[model samples]
Target chain A: MRGAVMHAPGDVRVEDRPMPTIVEPTDAIIRIAATCVCGSDLWPYRGLEPVAAPQPMGHEYVGVVTEIGEAVREIRVGDFVVGSFFSSDNTCEICLAGYQTHCVHRGPGAASGGQAQYTRVPLADGTLVATPGQPDADLVPSLLAASDVLGTGWFAAVAAEVGPGKTVAVVGDGAVGLLGVLAAKQLGAERIIAMSRHADRQALAREFGATDIVTERGDEGVARIKELTGGLGAHSVIEAVGTQESMMQAIRATRPGGHVGYVGVSHDVSLPGLELFFSGVHLHGGPAPVRRFLPDLIDRIWRREIDPGKVFDLVLPLEEAAAAYRAMDERRAIKVLLTV
Target chain B: MRGAVMHAPGDVRVEDRPMPTIVEPTDAIIRIAATCVCGSDLWPYRGLEPVAAPQPMGHEYVGVVTEIGEAVREIRVGDFVVGSFFSSDNTCEICLAGYQTHCVHRGPGAASGGQAQYTRVPLADGTLVATPGQPDADLVPSLLAASDVLGTGWFAAVAAEVGPGKTVAVVGDGAVGLLGVLAAKQLGAERIIAMSRHADRQALAREFGATDIVTERGDEGVARIKELTGGLGAHSVIEAVGTQESMMQAIRATRPGGHVGYVGVSHDVSLPGLELFFSGVHLHGGPAPVRRFLPDLIDRIWRREIDPGKVFDLVLPLEEAAAAYRAMDERRAIKVLLTV
Candidate 1:
């Protein structure tokens, strides 16, 4: 099998790797059908996140199960499925409480690497959610999105408590943030505001049901959101950029008693206790329990109810994983999908 | 009129002051029935919070409305009422959303020196909740507790989402934290863990329905809570101590998808964003919108269903407020009530 590996920062290479096999009674082997480079991947790729030794890349995947261990019951061989970055025994207490990302028996999906021809998945019955049927080829990207981004965006929206009568503001214009606008819309938000500077992303944001777009950054962005919401700030704010500035903007753009659902991978962000305490907003987010939303997201995609795949503006073969990483790092693509 | 004023750290004087009069159309003058020193007051009195020029101290008050401006509607002269630290116009959008503390027309109740014979309350119609009848002398302390500590504690419990079957951990043993245990119990929490080291405070906490008492502080306290909850942490945590240690313990003691309601007046605490993000806990808190819970609380007190006033362990005349402050500062009293 061939998979993308990074020996050092900015050194991504597709190299031969041993094929993965089910090693646990609850494990299953999946032949990768689709995978993608994530913004999180850029952290180590850009050297912002340290990389120790050569490591396989990619945690997002939509694939077809090729083999299953004895204990795997719900998921079977040959079924197309979507799974999250974190594999969990979804029946665990934490998972039962809708936070599979913190499941007692949780493990990273990148252990065997999803950006490969074949990968081993632990806790297959709980981690993977099968579509009603093998999805149409056109729906593949959207299904792939359910593995992480779309479900993450949905989690952000839900955590933000976006619902009917809510005015939602989204910080960060990445694929997750753009999809957050879609999620908020689907969740019945009365208005959606997308904070973006790029013309292309702004257009897509509008297409995704954004009622307003603000290009200002930092304090100005917060002030603009307040101005648009009658000086009270939005009812819900989704933060998809984990920088201190973005976090403050998201917190400041939410009204007292509002919600700030932040899903961005935070980096060196120290939230001032005084500011957050006085903000009077509910803060909830983490590695979104995407597995919790998989069944519903897969159903939505299967029914063609939402086109989450629109987030993937660039697509490449598995061997072009390096280019995909570059495109995302350079902001040339919101998301990039790789066909195996 | 005589009011308690902090001239400097460790310097409190009950000195003569001009009688308060309704200055705004929405204001009302309250004849102090009972008022008390608060934990927040210690911040400035101890010089942790700045005390510039003999600042009038105290914000918690339960009193009789003696005079009202033309615009004051809900409160009438001779009506016994309980109000919060912050006076808010209840009709504001923020107030209507149940965050009256952040109301657009909000003002500090301490501005007129609540620890005085007479004080002017702004937004009288919204800030004050009238009791069904004049509360008996025995209920005065409890009613005063409702003015701030009880209300704050109740808000913290509500923010923590304490309800039936929930395991609640309280991170402070002060008046507000003790009251939080009572609030959680009243809200139907099955198991209430009160974190306290003081035998007296612990006894009071148990009396207030605390099911368990953890004497350890900080990390050890969190570990004790987790151990008690099968290593999963509590479903709800109320943080009433505004220090880095207490804040972190509250966050760490809450399970993923659980809620942490923090009402402490945070001073030097800085929350690391990455750790908070990974905690997957819902955080919500601020100045308690006591006005939002005033009516319900008043009714409960009227029915004699819960006694929140037992937290006031010391009592003194208005002239001895200096001694009252000293007792609380020396940790000799949980709370001090001052009578006019």
Candidate 2:
């Protein structure tokens, strides 16, 4: 089987690798039908994070179950499924509380990368959510989106408490942020502000229900949000870029007592306690518990209520995995879908 | 009029000062019946925070309304009132949304300084909440507690979402943390863990309905909390100490989906973004919007449902203001009440 591996920063390669096998009683092997390069992948590729060893490259996928362990009762071979980046037992107290990403019985499942021909998923019965039936080819991309970005964006919107009569401001223009606009609209936010400078992304944001666009950064962007919100800042701010500047901007853009739902994997960000203390904003975020929202999101995608797959503007064959990484690294694509 | 003045970090004096007069149309001059030394004031007295000049120092008071400006409508002269450290207009959009501390019309009102014979209160109509009538001398200490520490602790408990069937952990054992225990019990929390090393404070916590007590710090403390909670951490955590260690402990003590409501006046605390991001906890704090809870807290105090004023262990006459500050600084008193 072939899989994507990173030998070092900026060196993603498609190479022959052994096919994954069910090693545990609750494990299952899935034949990947679709996977994609994510915004987070660029972190190591761009050398923002150290790539000390050759590593598996991706964590988002939609696939068909090729084999299932004896203990996996809910999932079986030949079933199409979507799984979250993080696997969970789904029976633990934490999982029962709707925070499956932090399941105490199991560790983060993303360490077992999904960018491969055949990937083994641990705790299969609890992690994988099957579609109603075999999804058609056109539905594959959307289902793949639900594996991470779309569900993550939805979680960000929900954490931000976006709802009727609320004005929401998004602080990033990546695929997750773009989908956040869609989620905010779905949640009935009265106004949506997308902070982006790229023309192409701005257009997509507008199409996805962004009521306004701010092309500034940091203080200027926060000021613009305040101006648009009648000097009180937006009622909710979605932070999809996890940088010091973006986090500060998100905090400043939200009105006091508002919510800041930050979904970006934070890097080099340190918040001064005094500043955050005086901000008077509710701060809640982390790795999205995508498994918690997978069922509903898959249903929404199947009904064609949303089209979040549009974020993948570039598609490449799995053999061209290096080129896919480059496209995302150079900002030439919002997201890249790789065909298996 | 006589007032408490901080000549330097460790020097406090009671001296004659010009009496305050109404400066704004909504301002009121209150003749303080009682005031108290707060834990936050120890920040500067211990030289953790600098005192630039000889500053009037105090923000907690129960007093009689001596005079009211022409525009003051809600409060009248001779009314026994309890007001927060931060005066809010209580009618702005932020106030209407229940964050009166961040009222759009006014910022933090700590500059008014309540440690005086007569102090001017800005936004009188919104900032001051009067009791049913003048109370006996014995209730003065309790009413004064409602002015800040007790209100702050109550807000912390509320923010942490303490309720039936939940486990709550308190990180500080000062007057505020002690009062937080009382608040959690009043909120019907099933179990309350009070972390304290002081025997007196521990005894007070037990009296205030603490179900468990842990005298540990740092990783050891976190380990004890995990051990007591079956390794999942508490459902709610109240942070009453504004330090990196206490903040991190509060964050670590809460479960992934739990809440940390911090009311400590943050000093030099800096939170690592990645740690906070991965923690998956809800974080909110600051100078509590005490005005939002004033009505309910006052009603409870009036009906004798809660006795938060018991936190004050040392009482002194107004002339002994210097001794009051020293007693709190040396940890000889959990809280100091000064009668005017």
Candidate 3:
């Protein structure tokens, strides 16, 4: 088997590696059909996060189950499935409460190291959601998106309490943020505002149901949002950028008693309690419990109700993972699909 | 009129001040029947908050309306009323959303300078909620509690979504925190854990329906709460202490997907974004919109269903405001009531 590995920052190589096998009685082996480079992957690739060793490079995938341990009952071999970035037993108290990402028995190994020919999925019965039937080739990217990005964006919208009569402002233009606009629309938001400076991203945002676009960043961005919302700020703000400036802007761009749903992984961000307190907005987000939304997302994609696959503007073979990483790091692609 | 003024930290004195009169078309003048020292007041008294000049020192009150401007509608002269710390025009969009404290036309003058013989209240119809009728003398303290402490506590419980089958942890033992225990109980929480070290407060907590009391602080307090909840933390945690330790404790004590309702007046607190993100709890709070809960709280107090006024352990005449401040400063009294 061949998989992408990072030896250091800015260096990704696809080389022959040992194939993954079911390590737990609940695990299953999947032949990777599709995978992608995620925004989180850039954290280490850009040297912002440490590269400890030659580490496996992906945590998003849609694949066909090749083998399953005896304990895996719900997921059987030959079924095409989508799995989240974190594997969970799905019966733990936390997962039952809809926070599968923090499930007591959550293990990242199952869904990670997936940019390869084969990968292991732990807690298979709980983590993988099969489509109604084999999905068409055109629907592959969207289903793969349900594995992480689309579900994550949907979670961010839900966390923000985006619903009918809400004015939603998205704080990032990445794939997740673009999908957030789609989620807000699907959730019946009255207005969707995309904060993006790039012409291409703005067009995609508009295509995804954005009613307005603001290119400003920082305090100016907050002020613009307030201006658009009659000086009260948006009813819901999705923060997909985890920088200090973006977080503060998201908080400030929400009206009192509004909600700020942040999904971007935090870096050196420190939130001033005084500001957050006075803002009077509900704050909720983390590693989104994508597993919780996978089934519904897959259904939507299978039904062709949403086209989240549009986020994949670039696609490359698995062996060209290095180019995929560079394209993402340089902002040349919103998301890149890697075909195995 | 005589009012309590703080010339500097710890320098509270009863002094002659101009009698308050209606200054806005919606203003009403009230003869102060009762006022009290709040935990927030202790911030300035303890030199934690700056006292730039001789500032009039109170924001809570229950009194008889003496006069009303032409625009005042709901409140009438001779009506006994309970008002929150901030006056808001209840019809505004923000107020209608149940965040009166952040109402667009909010004015502090209507509620502040209340530790005096007479004070003017702005937005009278919105800020002051009249009791069903004039109440007996015994109910005055409880009514006063509804003006701020009880209402704030109620807001915290509501924000934390304290409801049936949930485990609630209260992080402060002051008047508001004690009232929060009562609120949680009234909200149908199956188990209420009151975190406190003071025996007197612990007793009050138990009386307010605390199912368990943890005499631990910081990490130990969080650990005790988790241990009580099968190591998953509480479903709802109310933070009524503004310090960094109390804030972090409240966040860390809530389970993933749980809620943390913090109503403390935040001071010098910085939250590391990464830790808060990983905690995966819903954070909602700030200076509670007490006005939103004033009516219900006053009704409960009127029916004698609750006795939040027990927190006022000391009472004194208006002229002895200095001594009242001292008792609260030294922790000799949980709260102090001043009568005019």
Candidate 4:
């Protein structure tokens, strides 16, 4: 099996590797159908996050179960399934409370790297959610999205408490942020504001149901949101970019009693406690517990109620994984899909 | 009129001040029966928070309305009232959403300094909640507690979603934290953990309905909380101390998907974004929307359902305001009550 591995900065390669096998009683081997590059992957690729050792490259996937350990009960071989970047027992108190990403037993599945011909998944019964049946080829991309970005955006919207008559502001124009707009719209937000300067992203944002677009960044961006919100700021704000500037913008753009749902992998950021305290907004974030929303999102995608697949602006063969990373790294794509 | 002023750190004095009058149509003047020294007062007194100039010194009080502007409709001159540290026009959208502390029309009532012979309250109809009748002298201290500390503690409990079957942990042992324990109990939390090092404070915590007590601080304290919760963390955490250490403890002590309600006046604190992002706990804070809880708190105190005034261990005449500040600053008193 050939898998993508990063030897060093800007040096992602598709190389022959041993096929993954079920190693634990609850494990399953998945034949990758689709996977993609993520914004977070750029951190190490750009040398901002050190890759001291060769590392396997992707964490999002939609696949078919190829084999399962004897103890794996719910998942069966040849079943189409979608799982989050983190695997969980789902029965633990934390998982039961809907924070499967922080499951004590399974740890983060990102390190297993899904952008491969085949990958082994532990805690299979709890991690993977099977589709009603084998999904059509067209629905594959959308299901793959539910494995991460789409589910993440949905979580952000839910965390921000987007609902009827609420104004939601999205701080990033990336795939997650754009999908957050779609999620907010679906969640019944009265107004969705997408802060983006890029014409392409702006157009997509509007198509995804953004009622307003602000081209400015930083303080200007917050001011614009306040201006649009009648000087009170948006009732809910989604932060999909994990930078100091984006976090501050997200916090500052929410009303005193609003909520800020952040999904970006924070890097080099420290929030001033005094400002956050005085902001009087609810803050909840972390790695998205995408597993919590997989079923509903899959159902929605299957019913054609949403088309989150559009976020994958560029699609390529799994063998061209390096190019996929480059496309997203240079901002040539919102998200890249690598079909196996 | 006479008022307490902090001319500099540790220099509180009772001096002649102009009589407070109704300057705004929505204002009402109250002749204070009781005021108290808050934990936050020590910040400026200790010079940790600079006192640029002589400043009026208190924000918690229960009083009788002595004068009302023509436009003050809901309150009358002879009414006994309880108000929060921040005045609010409860009709604003924020106020309507139950975040009156962030009301748009009125300024922070702290500037009016309730530790005086008379104080002008803005947005009188919204900020002042009249008691059913003039209370007996014995209830004065309890009503004054509702003016700030009790209301703030209640807000913390509400924000933390304390209720039946939930486990609540309090991070500060000051009057507010102790009252947070009381609030959690009143809110029907199944268990309350009070983190306090002092024996007296721990006793008070137990009296306030704390089911468990941990005399640890920092990481050790968090470890103890986890130990108590079977290696998980409390479902709800109240952070009544504003230091970075306490903030992080509050966050780390909460289970994933739990809530941390912090009301301490955050000072010189910066929360590492990565840690907070990964904590997976709901964070909500600020100067509490005390006005939102004033009515219910007043009713409860009036009915003798709770005795929050026990927190005030030292009582002094208004002229001994200097001693009250010193007693609180030196930790000689859990709280200081000043009678005018």
Question: What lDDT does each candidate get?
Answer: 0.93, 0.90, 0.92, 0.92
Instruction: Say what the interface RMSD of candidate 2 is.
Output: 0.6
Clash pairs of candidate 4? none
Identify the candidate with maximal DockQ: 1
Local error of candidate 1 at residue A310 (angstroms): 0.7
DockQ of each: 0.93, 0.90, 0.90, 0.92
- lDDT computed for candidate 2: 0.90
Native-to-model Cα distance after best TM-score fit, residue A74 in candidate 4, in Å: 0.9
Over B17-67, each residue of candidate 4 has an lDDT whose tens digit, in order, gives 998877888899999999999998999899898899899989998889999
lDDT, candidate 4, A1-340, per-residue tens:
9999999999999999888876788898898899999898999999999999989888898889989999999999999999888889999999999999989885656336788988888899889999999998999989998999998999999999999999999999999999999999999999999999999999999999999899999999999998998899999999999999999999999999899999998898999989999899999988999999999999999999999999999999999999998999999999999999
Task: List, residue by residue over A236-274, the lDDT tens digit for candidate 3.
Answer: 999998999999999999999999999988789999989
Docking class of 3: high
lDDT of 2 by residue, B1-340 (tens): 8999998899999998887888889998898999989898888888888899998989998889989999999999999998888888989999999888899876435345678887888998889899999886777777888888888999999889899999999999999999999999999999999999999999999999999999998889999999999999999999999999999999999999899999987888999999999999999888888888888888888888778888989989888999999999989999999988
Instruction: Name the weakest run of 10 consecutive residues (lDDT summed) in model 2 chain A.
Output: A105-114
CAPRI rating of model 2: high
Residue by residue across B1-340, what tens digits does model 3's lDDT show?
8999999999999999988877778999999899998889889898998898789989889899999999988899999999889989999999999999999998883444989999899999999999999999999999999889998999999999999999999999999999999999999999999998999999999999999999999999989998999999999999999899999999999999999999998899999999988999999998789888888888888899999989999999989999998998889999999998
- Which residue ranges in model 1 land beyond 4 Å of their true spot? none
Candidate 2 per-residue lDDT, tens place, A1-340, comes to 8999999999998888877887888998888899999888999999989999999878898899988899999998999999888889999999998999999866545335677887888899888999999997888889999999999999999989899999999999999999999999999999999999999999999999999999999899988999999899999999999999999999999999999999999999999999999999999999999999999999999999988899999988888999999999899999999988
